[model samples]
Structure formats: C-alpha cells, structure tokens
Target chain A: MKKNIILASTSTVFGQPYLSYLKEELEILFADAKEIIFIPYARPGGISHDDYTAKAAAFFKEIRVAVKGLHNFDDPISALQNCQGIFTGGGNTFLLVKQLHELNILPTLRSVVDNGVPYLGTSAGSNLGGMTMQTTNDMPIVYPPSFETAGWVPFNLNPHYLDPIPGTTHMGETRETRIAEFHTQNSIPVVGLREGSWVRVTDHKIKLGGPLTARIFEQGKQPYELSPGASIEFA
Target chain B: MKKNIILASTSTVFGQPYLSYLKEELEILFADAKEIIFIPYARPGGISHDDYTAKAAAFFKEIRVAVKGLHNFDDPISALQNCQGIFTGGGNTFLLVKQLHELNILPTLRSVVDNGVPYLGTSAGSNLGGMTMQTTNDMPIVYPPSFETAGWVPFNLNPHYLDPIPGTTHMGETRETRIAEFHTQNSIPVVGLREGSWVRVTDHKIKLGGPLTARIFEQGKQPYELSPGASIEFA
Candidate 1:
C-alpha cells in the first residue's frame, strides 16, 4: 500500500474561511474515512488545545466528518495508531514538534503514515512532514527536544512561502534568503510552498497542487519555480 | 564602572549605507576603544564568516576603529576575553546562538558584558543580549545547543520589529501576534525594537535610543509604546 498525504501551505488563504479552499480536495482525501483525529498541539496565538481543536472540529463538521482532537484521547499514541485519518493544523512549529517529541510519538506517527493512514497537514503541520523544523516561519516561542521531525517526505518544507514584495523597505531577510541560510548548514532540498499551494503525496509520487508555482531550493544552485501539477518527487 | 552596550535594531536603516545611520552614535559608543573584535557567526545569506567580518570592518574603518573577526583568533574564548570591545553583527540568530553554545563561549561573552567591556550588537546580535532568543524574528535555520543567551538585560529584545502593514491581505501572523504568542509561553517582558531604534544599557539603566518608539509586550497586559530615551528597566 502507498502512503497518502496532503501538505498545504496554510489552513486558510486570505479572505477565506478556515479550510474552505481545500474542501473539495479534502473530501476526496478523506472520502473513505468517517472520522479523523486532529492534533492541536501547535496552538496558534497560544490558544488552548481544546479551543484550537474545536476550531478544527468546526471545519471538519462542515464536510460531514467527525473530528476528535488527539488531546482528548487517553493515550495519544494509541489514538494515532488506530485513526483512519489525521489532520494537524498550523501554529508554532517548535511547540508542535516539542509536544510530539515529549509524547514520544514521532516514530508512531511516521509508522502509521507509512502504513497508509491518510494524513493532512497545514503550515506548521506540513513543515513537520519534512526532514526538520529548521525551515519554519513561525517564531521559536518554545524549545523542542530536537529539530528533527517526521520526515514523511524526503526533503524539508518552507510553508506559506512568500516572494519578496517589490519596493518593500523591510530589512528582514526574504523567505528565499532565509532558506538559503538553511541550506548553509543543511544539505536537504527545500520546497517553498506558496500560499494556496500544496503537495500531494501518493505512494512515491509527490506533485504540486493549487494554481501557483512552488519554488525549489537546493544547495549550490539557483532556486527555480515549479508549476502546479509538476512532479516534486525528484526534488 | 557600569556595563556599556549598544543594541540596535538593525545594522542599517533602509536606503542607508551599511551601519551609516548608527555611525555617529557608534563613534560615541566606542570613543575610548581603539579596536573591537567582531563576531560573524550569523553570516547573512550564508556568506562566509570572513566575508561578513570584512563588511563590518569596512564600516568600522570609516570610524577609524580597527576591527578583527573573532574567527581570526586561534582561540575564540581567549579572543573574547582579551578584547577591549566587541560587536556582533546580525544575520540568523539560531546560527549565532548555535556557534556561541558550541564554542562554549556564551558564559565568557556574558561575563565580559557584565564586567563592563564595551559591547555593540545589531539585530541577531542584539537579540542575544536578552533573556533568551525567544523574541527573535529570524527563522530557525539550525538547532542551537540552547536558546539561553547572555541575559545581560532583564527582558528579551525583538529586533527589526515591524508594525502590520495596513490593508494587507496576507494571512500570516503579524509581528505583534508572534510576540504575543511568545508572551503566552514565557513570562519575561519583550521589547519590540523597530528599525532605527535601539536600547542603550549603562549599569542597571536601559533606555530606548534612536529616533523611534518601541513596542513592549508583557504577559496579560496590553502592549504599549515607549518613545526615545524612555526607560525600559522596569518593563
């Protein structure tokens, strides 16, 4: 059996309701599953785990899918193992990775995903699917036990990746520059998933989804754009 | 004697030459020092440490102060200890902290600052003087041994701090939201130092310098602004 996954740049694009843009794709992604477990460990704006999970539940409710937060379970590891599908929402990557490491479930999460359990990840969640959390745009509000992540995919991911705004005076490094710095210390390839874009992984194939082009970063090379539907498997 | 420090939000303001905006202030700040060692581990854009140091040296040359890269010394610890003044330029905070911890010189750096050796830091460099690197806006491109920094100042400093661009449709978390999230996880106060703004530390007194007002974030309280020369010691 092949692994199935959808890694999105964000849960919601600008002016859109939560998860609304990805609804149609998500329907097919979770078509066979009646219920999906949600992991709310990232907790945006430091929202409570229950409150964050409730937000996810509300979204999944619209698609007629039952949503239960991983935190609600007696044993999160067991809950993950038995789940048919899992959706991890966006927030602080460090916090999410910290909780996953502290709970000693990174291996379990990877095993289930490898076993063909459908998975959906947005923003920080998508970042975790990569080799490490080092490319995250989120603030390092908390410290994780390790920078290592699920590595469901072979490369690192830079989610919600933005192109440099023209004529902007902000002195902060561009997303491109930040990732280049990442490559300085790491040799892994990085896929810069723009807003409204995603990567769909089916078995060994990974293809870019959504209308925009995704940027690819590799060591000692200029970053280039990949059009939607382009195969990133070779990246 | 009191510790003398200059923690600027950036090396240069937009449209200004590198370190040009701070030149006048830097001259006064380093008036008594003939030479200052530079720490360039945070290499911007993955530039080599030597190259980054050259950029700093060029700027300091105009002020007639001899500059040397910390990496030039055979022993970084001894280089730090024997230096009359030190300047750490900004790039990526994680890399900077990683090198500092790996070299086992964070303690040495802190002790020198506490002992009143002249110090100058901009952006990543400035963030290190804070309680922790929790408030840094830079991406985490590497895993440092620890997030603990010099803690020379009581509160954390958020450099290159930006106000949300009005009427923007971007859904990414604003700078304010990111820091607010930091407050949720940590109890320490965070001062959002905007570009062109800096904090001058003399003994126990910390006063906002430069021409702009800075935003301060404290747990369970509304964020407020502090104008130039405003004391942040009690924040």
Candidate 2:
C-alpha cells in the first residue's frame, strides 16, 4: 500500500463554499470509496464534533458518498481500519493533536494512512501530515503531549500561509518571519501552502496544486517559491 | 508584597526607539532599584540570548540602571532572587516558556514578582504573567513542558493583538476568533492587548495603559473593549 492524500491549505478560500474548489479532485481521489471517516476533532471555530462532522457529510453527500464521524465509532482504530477514506477537517491543531495523542492511536492512524488509505485534510487537518505541528499558525488553546504529527508527508506544512500585506503598520510577525523563526531551532523543511493551494500526494509523487505558487523554507537557506504543478517529491 | 508589574504588548512600536514610549514610566517604576535582571529567554526573531540582552541593556543604560542577563549568571535562580528588578523581553512564547519550565524556576520567579520586586514584561514576556501562554499568537516552534505561566496576573494575555484588517480577503482567523476558540474549551479570560497597549499592576489594581483600548474576552460572553486607564482589576 502506498500513500494517497490531498493536503489542502484550507477547506475554502475567501468567498468560496465549503470545500467547493476541491470537489472535483476529491471525487477523483475517493472515486472507488462509498464513504469516508471524517475526523472532526479539530472543531473549526470551536464547533462541536457532531456539527463539524455534519458539515463534512454535507459536502460528501453532494458527491454521492456517505460520511461518518470518527467520534461516532466506539473504536477509532477499528473505524480507521474499516473506513474507505478519511477526511480531517480544519480547526485548532492543538485540540486535534491532543485528542489524537490522548487516544494513544497516532501510530495506528499513521500506519493506516501509510498503507494507502485515501485521505483528505484541510487547514489544521492538513498540518497533521507533517513531521510536527511546530509550524502551525493556530493558538495553543490546549496543551498536547507532543508537537509531533502523523509524518505522512516528508516535510512539515504551514497551511493557509499568507504573505505580508503591503503598507501595513501592524507589528505582528509575518508568515515568513514566523517560519524563519521555526527554522532557527528546527532543521525540517516547511511548505508554505497559500490559500487555494494544496499538495496532492499519490504514493511517491507530491505535486503542488491550485493557482498559487507555494513557498518552501529550509534551514539556513533562502525561501524559494514553487509554482503550481511543481513537484515537491524532493522536499 | 502585592504585585507591581508592567506587562507590555510589544517591546517596540513602529517608528519608535526600543522601549522609548515606556521609558518615563519605567524610570518611575524602577526608581528605587539600581539595576534589573534581564531574562532573554524569549529571543525575539530567533536572536541569540546575549544579543537580545544587549538590546535591553542599551535601553536601560539610558535610565542609569545596570542590566544583567539571567543567562550570564552561574545560577539563574539565585540571580533572580538577589536581583533588584526583573525584566523579560519578547520573542516566541513557546520558546520562552520552554526555557523557564526546563529551568524549573517559574515558581521562584512568580514568588518574587508577587512579593513586590519590580517586574517588566513585553509580548511573550507579558504572556508569562498570565495563567498560561495558550493565548499567545506566536508560532509554536518548540513544545514546552506545560502551558502554565507565572499566574501573577489572574487572566491570560494575548499580546500584539490585531483586529481584522478592514476589507482584506485573507482568511486566517482574527485575534478575537482565536481567543474565542480558546474560550470554547478553557474557562480563563483573555485580554487582547493591542500593540502599544499594556497593563500596569500596582498592588491589587490593574489598569489598562498606553494610547489604545484593549479587548477582553470571557467565555460565553461578547468581547468588550477596555479604554485606556480603565481598571481590569476585576479581570
């Protein structure tokens, strides 16, 4: 089994419907599957598990596929093993990782994802594919046992990445500055996946998707831009 | 033996010298002390400890008070105990908290601040005065042993806080949304300290300082604005 994943920067770009842009790609990726196990642990905007799950289910319903929240299952490990596809929605990364680690099934989740389960992730969900969540932009509302992620992807991710707005007087650090700070103490490469952009991973091939160019940050090196359709297999 | 602290939202505002706006207030706060111990653990922008300390040293030098980096001493705990005043600079909050917890001196540091030793903190440094650093906006470049902070202040602080940029299309969560998400799980109140705004704690009184108003978020309540000079003592 080889990895099959769609790591999206965000579920929706500004003025877009929920997961609307990725609908075609999703239909292709999960073509053979009848249903997906939706992990709503991230709970975007502090939404409840059931509500977040319903949102994903609504999207999949349009594609004629059934959806089930992982929380609905008594055994999450068994759920993953039995599910045709998996979709982790956007939300707070800390909360998601906390639940994952607390369940003590990160290894199981990673193993199944590694074994070629069709997976879809957005925002915080996409961040879970990295080696660690150190590059996340979300607030640490909760403390997790570790910063480690699923490591389904070779490099860490910075989803919903934004370039600094010009002529702004705000003193808050920019996306690039924050990632540079991450590199100061970390050696891993980080992919700055801008809004409307994503990474499509099919076994060994990882291609940048969408209209925007991605930014790649490696320690001690200048960050370079990656155009749409660029291959990040070497990253 | 009551808290006497200055928690600033940022170390420097745009178009101003470092710590310039607060120089007069600082001189008055540290009037009784001949020197202040500087904790450079935050290491803003990934700067080195000594380099960041020197920046603070230069600013304090103008006020005729000596400055010493906590890292310069052979024993950090003893140095802190014997210090006349203490100042912690801003940087990555996770990195700052990680070092403080690893050193196992948060309790000692908190005890002294609660005992009326003059204390100054900016950005990440100020977040340390809260119950936890979970409200911080910085990237979590490193994982700390805990989300706990000194708790010298009753509520958590969100420094360098920014409201949504008017009319822009970026979809990242606003400061208010992030804090609201934090409140979804944690019950602690979070103070959104705008850049250039700060809180001055004198004995039991906590007053909002600087030119701008601050925002306060309590769980299950609408976020309210706090005008300068307003008392957050109830917070």
TM-score, candidate 1, is 0.98
lDDT per residue (tens digit) for residues B50-154 in model 2:
999899999999999999999998998998888899999988999999999999989889999999999999999999999999999999998898989999888
The local lDDT score (0 to 100) that residue B58 gets in candidate 2 is 96
Count residue pairs with overlapping backbones in model 1. 0
User: Candidate 2, B121: how far from true, in Å?
Assistant: 0.3
Cα lDDT of model 2 by residue, A1-235, tens digit: 5889999999988898999999999999899899889999998788999999999999899999999999999998988987889999988999999999999868988989899889999999999999999999999999999989999888999998988878877787889999998988899899999999999999888899999999999899899999899899553
Which parts of model 1 have CA positions greater than 4 angstroms off? none
lDDT of each candidate versus the true structure: 0.91, 0.91
Report lDDT (Cα) of residue B147, candidate 1.
94
Look at candidate 1 and give me any clashing residue pairs: none
TM-score of the A chain in model 1 = 0.98
How well is each residue in A1-235 modelled by candidate 1, as lDDT tens digits? Answer: 4889999999999899999999999998998888999999998888999999889989888889999999889998999989989999999999999999999989999999988999999999999899898889998999998989988888989998989999989898889999988888889999999889999999988899999999999988999999899999653
